[model samples]
Each structure stands twice: as C-alpha cells, then as structure tokens.
Target: MKDLKGKVALITGGTKGIGYGVAEALLRQGLKVVITSRDENAANEAADSLASKTNSKGAVIGVQADVRRLDSQKEAVNQALSTFGQLDIVIANAGLGHFGSIEELTVEQWNDVIDTNLSGVFNSIKASVDALKESKGYYITISSLAGTNFFAGGSAYNASKFGVTGFTQAVMLDLRQYGVKVSTIMPGSVSTHFNGNEPSDKGAWKIQIEDMGELVVDLLKMNPRTLPSKIEIRPTTPPSK
Candidate 1:
C-alpha cells in the first residue's frame, strides 16, 4: 500500500461500466492496469485510452477474455504476468443477467447467467491465485444486492450472485493465510448497461459508476488488518420518492 504507481491490476469486463470506472481510478492513481473485454477491439480501445490518460510508462494493457471459461481466465493471467510480472489486484467483474420466472426461465438462460456470474469469478480467482499470492494483493468480486434481495423476475441473477457472495467469503478465508484479501461489493442499483441496454441520462437517479470506483480505491487504502469482506450499497434516494 506504500505506492500504487508500480502496482498492476487485472480487471474483467472493463469497457463501459463500473469496471471501466475502476480502471480509470486505478490509472489516475498511477497503477498499471490490464483491462479485459470479450471483444478484442473494445479491449484495445480501452487500453489505449487508459494509457494516454495515465501517461505512465506502459501503464495499460488489454486482453480479450471470456470470463465464463477457465482457459480464457488463465490466458488473461498469463497475459498479465508476462507483461506486468506481478498482479496486485484482480477484479472479477464480468457478469450477465437474464430475467424471467423460475418456471419460464430456459435452461440455456440459467446456464448462461450462472456461467458468467458465478463460474466467471471462480475462473478469475483460480487463474490469479499464484500471482496474487506472490504479491499479497487484493481480490474483489463485483456482486449485486440481488444476492440478498431476490425478486420475482431475478431468479437467475439472484441465484448466481448469491452463490458469488458465498464463494467469495469462503475463498477469503482460504486466501487470508497467504496475505491476500478477498472482498465482495454488492451495489443495489447501478446505472450501467448490464443487460446489453444503453445507459442514458435518465439513469442518473441510480448509483453512478464512479461511486463504486471510489469504493474500490478506498478499500485498497484501508488498513491491511481490517478486511471489509462484504459491502452492501444502495442509492441514497430512489426515483424521487
């Protein structure tokens, strides 16, 4: 925690949402960042933009990774390790949602949500375990309040996020002995294009993307002895009511 200048962070699904916001904050803090996107073009674009803004020597690198696959996650780690040597933080942020009634939700839809939201986190941690251990760094999972608050149409998303919360807690205990801190951030209603929707000005009432970015940085600055294992965030005011 002495300096973030030379530290490296690997963030998944870092294009146009909370992940990108975190990348921007880390870059501004002078940290080297590797941002992954499922699409190569988007990843490269984000990396270049970050590099220009950060102006650190070789500050940003991007890789195409699909978090649902272990091989893709391993490849992302290899890219980070080969380019940056050590990983100081790993953010498991890639996720998707498909809303429907339990009776109406298709098998394919359920698997898609679970694979990306839950299995993706598993892949990310498994991939970076060694590098993070060597650096004694941080591991953060971007979960959702859906993990705790389940609604009628959120069956798939709720199940996956709930599992993510449970898994992250158990993994925290396992990694704590190795000096790695694991935590989960559960934001209630973020204004992001989580389900392939476009974010508009009307979304302003929800939590802003930069808020979670600030939260991540704050967590990093906290004392190492104190681990904020689970954080629940909600919008201060809801829909002017």
Candidate 2:
C-alpha cells in the first residue's frame, strides 16, 4: 500500500461511474487494474479508454463478470491473477436502486436490489478473500448515504446499503487478523448514472466520480497501522430547499 506501483486491483462493475473513475485513478498511480462488467463490450471499451487516457506505466484490462454470482466473481478474480499475477485490492462498487413504497414495491425489484447490492458484495469478497489474505491487501465497498439514513420509498435500497455497511465493518474485523484491510464508502448525491439519472452540468454541485476515485486512492496510500473502517461523504453544499 505504501508502495502502490505494480499492485493489482480487481473492481466489480468498473465499466462506468465510480468503478471506472477508481480504475483511472489507480492506473494513474501505477497500479495494474482488472475492471469487470456484466457487459463485455462496455468492459473492453472502458479498459481501452482508461488505458488510452492514462500513461502506460500502469496497466488495465476489462473482463465480463457479474457480482451477483459467486462463480462469475471467482472467474473475474482468476482473470486478474492470470493477467496481473496478483490481486491486492478489491472494490465492490456494483449496485442498483429501485425506489417505491413497500406497498408498491415488486418482489422482482426487491430481489434485484438485494442481489446486486448486498449479495453482490458478499460474492465479490468470497471470490477474492483468499487472494487478498495472501497479499495482505485492501477491500473497499461502495455503499451509500442511504446505508445510514432512511427515507420514504427507499425500502429496498436502504435495506441493501444498511446491510452492506454492517457487512463491510464486520468483514474488516474478520480480515484484519490476516492483514487484509476492509472499508466501506457511503456517499450522497454523486454525479453519475444511477437509477436512470443522467450526468450533466446541472449535477456539478454534486460529488463527482473523480472525488470518489481520489478517496479510494487516499485509502490505499494510508499507513498500514491505521484503518478508516467506515466513511460517509456528502456534498459540501447544495441548493437551498
């Protein structure tokens, strides 16, 4: 961690949004990255774009994998090991939201949200825990402010994120003995395409994807003796309601 050069990271749902941004940041820091997406084209395209935009000192490759399935996650970890020779970081950043009152929420929506947000984190960790233990690496999960704060119509998302926050903290305790670090980032009002919203200038006041990327880099560079287990980030300012 102190010396990040050539370290390997496996990021789930890295084709765009926070995952893509973090990949770019790690590449800029001279780390090799494996970014996964369920879509093959998006994954490859993102890898190519990141590689082209950053200096060649750090390498990046994209693989197709779904965090919801343990087998798929295992394949992604295997791909990272085969290509980069080691896995030092794991970022579970894949998630989705479906907002509605519980009375109107569909079983399908609830399943999708829980499967991708909660179980997905578990699959990602389960797939890479051994590799991380071997490397004594870091595992970071992208939860949400919703994890801690609840609102009407946020039942499914709130449940999943709350689970993620608690799950990650417990994992930190479980993994620390092995020298693997674990942390979760919960952010509010980020400018990205989440839940069908598009990113544009209007969202300039929101937390930017690059900001999340920077935070992840800082976590990676921190002293090994210190661990910031849970972090909540929000925009410095927002329009007056």
Candidate 3:
C-alpha cells in the first residue's frame, strides 16, 4: 500500500453517507481530512464524530460550503490548504438525485440535480485543480450507474450522472499531463440515506458505504504509473425485484 501518512484530503458532501465513510477510510491511512457540508453544524458534528471513531484527533476538520457555488468550493479548498498545509486529494462526492418523468420533474428539481451532480463537480475541480496540480494529487468523483443505464423516471438524474461520467473522463485526459490523476467511481444502488430514503435491512443486498470507502483507499494505493480512469462497482448479489 502507498504510504499516505501526512497526506491531506478534502471531501465535499462529507457529513454523512459515502462521504463520511471515505473520510474514515482515509483517516485510517493517516491522511488528514477536511469534510464539507452545506450545514455548518452537521459538518462540524460529523468531523468530530469521525475523529473520535478513527482515533485520529486533530486529523479531521469540517467546512461548511455548498458545491453549487464556485466560491463555496474555493473556500473549502482554501480551508484544507490552510489547515493541513497541503492538499493531496480531492473527492468530489457531493451529489443529489431527483427521479421523475420529464414532464413530471419540476424545473427546480432538474436544476437541483444538474447543479449538484454536474455543475457542482465542475466547480469543485476548478477550485481545487491548482492545489492538486501543485501536489500532483488525485481527483475522484462519485458518479452513479444511472450514468450508463437510463431507467424510467430517471430523466434528470440520468442526465446529470451521465454528464458527471463524461466530464470526469475528459478531465482525466486534461490533467494527466500535469501528473494529477483523475477518476470516477460509478456505483449501483448504494445503501445510503440518499434521495430521502433511509437505508434499512431490506437494502442490505446493495453496496454498502464502507465498500466505497475501501475502493477509494485502494485507488489511492494503486501504482502511480497505472491509473484506473473509470471504475464501475455493483453489489455481488443484488436482490431481484
């Protein structure tokens, strides 16, 4: 495994779910973590909880910022740099989903999905690209299977995730020359509190948050010469509907 001691990472939408899981995984690898949430209290609380869980005091910090705004993203990145003194990794994990038929989907819902899932990623990468370039770091985004397989009532969500997958690929090409690695992980049916649904025993067959966390750590440990530009992950045994 790559020695990540003293490395620093900034994760967006990190107060809970997959983001929080990844933060814990990185912290275990001795990486300083900065997590962001749109809610200040949630961000701070999650950070504190993660620090306690990981037994890595002073290794985690929280920043309140919304990914939809470039300024907010920039502030989060700046906080990571100022706090940790360097930014080695950026996980653009902030996202949302609004599933509905085209006609049934409200404009606000479409925009929310687009802005958070697609534009939010763009804003995140733009804000952190310079710092990542300086550190020759890694940039990873959390996309979804909807990006590749369209389903009914998934118009806006599919569009946004498709955009994320494509945008991340293009960025990998653009940033590779700078020695900065970029990749996108597209997961299917993760068991998280996403889209206002609570994760329960019934969803146990789906991919768990810790699975994604381990995937991120594995990516970070991969040989620098080899970059897995795109990864698709699914549960080994998804329940039949």
Candidate 4:
C-alpha cells in the first residue's frame, strides 16, 4: 500500500468539487495538504472545514492563487513549502468549461478555457517539479471524458480537455525517469460545480463528489511500481432516458 502518512500534497482549485474532495481524503490519511483557490475567503473556509473534520489544522493550509497565472502558482508553491517544508503530491484539478458551436465560440472564450485548463497545468507542474523530484512524488490531473468524446456544442471544452490529456501524458513520460509518477483521471458526467453548473442544482444526476474523493484515496494506496496512468471513472448507473 502507498504510505501517505507524513506526505505533503498540493491541490489546485481545492475550494470545491473534486479538488476539495481530494484534499479532504489526503488530510484524512495524515498527509499535509495545501489547497489553493482563487478566492482567499473560499480557500480559508475549505481548509478549515477539512482540518476540523480531520482534526489536523496544522496539516492543512489554504492559499489563494489563480490557476491561470504563473505568479499565483508560485505563491501557492511557496506557501506550501513554507508551511509543510516539502511536497509529495500534486492534483491539477483547476479548469474551466465553455460550450458552444465551434463557429459561435469566440476566440476570447477559447483562450480562456485553454489558458486555465491546459496552460495552468503547465505552470503548476513547473512550480512543483523540484519538490516532486525531491520526494519521488505523484502527480494527478483531473481530466475529463470530454477529452475523448466530442459533442456538437462542446468545441471549446473538448479542445481544452484534449490538450489536458495529451499534456499530462507527455509530462508523465518526461518525469518518469526522475522517479515521479504522473496520472490523469477522467470522469464521466460527475455532479459537481464544473463549468457553470452548481453541484447542488436540481439537474444534478451523475456521480457524487465524494465518490471521486474515494477514488483518489484508493489511487494513493496503489503500489509504486504500478502507475495507473489513465483512469476513467463513470457512474455505475446512468439516469433513465
């Protein structure tokens, strides 16, 4: 089993949804968790809630960082190293989605999604690679099934997710020789605050947030020699048509 006690993990966009869930699981495993959100207040609330439930305030630190900005990512890493002294895991879960016909998708909208979902991952890995190298750490990206399946109005979102999966796989190869394990998790129709949809909305009919959290916990416990590079999680049952 992968030993997580005494480990340190940095989760981006961790104020809610899958990101927050992953942080909660890591904290419960006794790993020092540093979570980042664009909003300082939200970050504080999430950190406090996780720490309170885990009964380990010292092990949970919250930082405010815009995933789209490299400078913000730098601050996040600095805060993590300062608070935890090292880093062992990174979950690049920060992303955005905008759906529209390719012709209707404005250039600005396309840029926004690509910058936050793809370039943001690059910035995150660059900032944290050294620490990961030092720790033989693991890196996981919260990609999407949209990366593979394309829909008519999903031009921007599909391209963005496609870039994410490809980028994650390439980085995994680049870092594997350095003892770092990289993986991308793709979930289908998860009920979360992804895109503009509130997780608690009435239309929510898919996998629960906590189930993905449990999946992350399970991944953490997998053997080191085995790296499940690509994980696709979908609901066992879908809504009736």
lDDT of each: 0.91, 0.95, 0.94, 0.87
Q: Which ten-residue region of model 1 has the weakest summed lDDT?
A: 49-58
Give stretches of model 2 more than 4 Å off.
none
- Tens digits of per-residue lDDT, candidate 4, 1-241, equal 3778999899999988888888888887888998998889999999999989889878898899988888889889988988889989999998888788888889999999999988899989988898899989999998899999888999888888888899999999999999899999999988877767776655456877778888888887898888999998887768788
Give the lDDT of residue 220 in candidate 4.
77
Better of 1 and 2 by lDDT: 2
The digit string of per-residue lDDT tens for model 2 on 112-189 reads: 999999999999999999999999999999999999999999999999999999999999999999999999999999
- Candidate 3's residue-wise lDDT over 6-122, tens digit each? 999999999988999999999998999999999999999999999999999999999999999999999999999989899999999999888878889999999999999899999
RMSD of 2: 1.0
Q: Estimate, for each residue in 60-87, the C-alpha lDDT of model 1 and write its tens digit.
A: 8889999998999999999998898888
Q: What lDDT does candidate 2 reach at residue 48?
A: 91
Task: Judge candidate 1 against the unseen true structure and give its global Cα lDDT, from 0 to 1.
Answer: 0.91
TM-score of each: 0.96, 0.98, 0.98, 0.95
Single out the weakest 10-residue window by summed lDDT for candidate 2: 53-62
lDDT of 3 at 130: 95
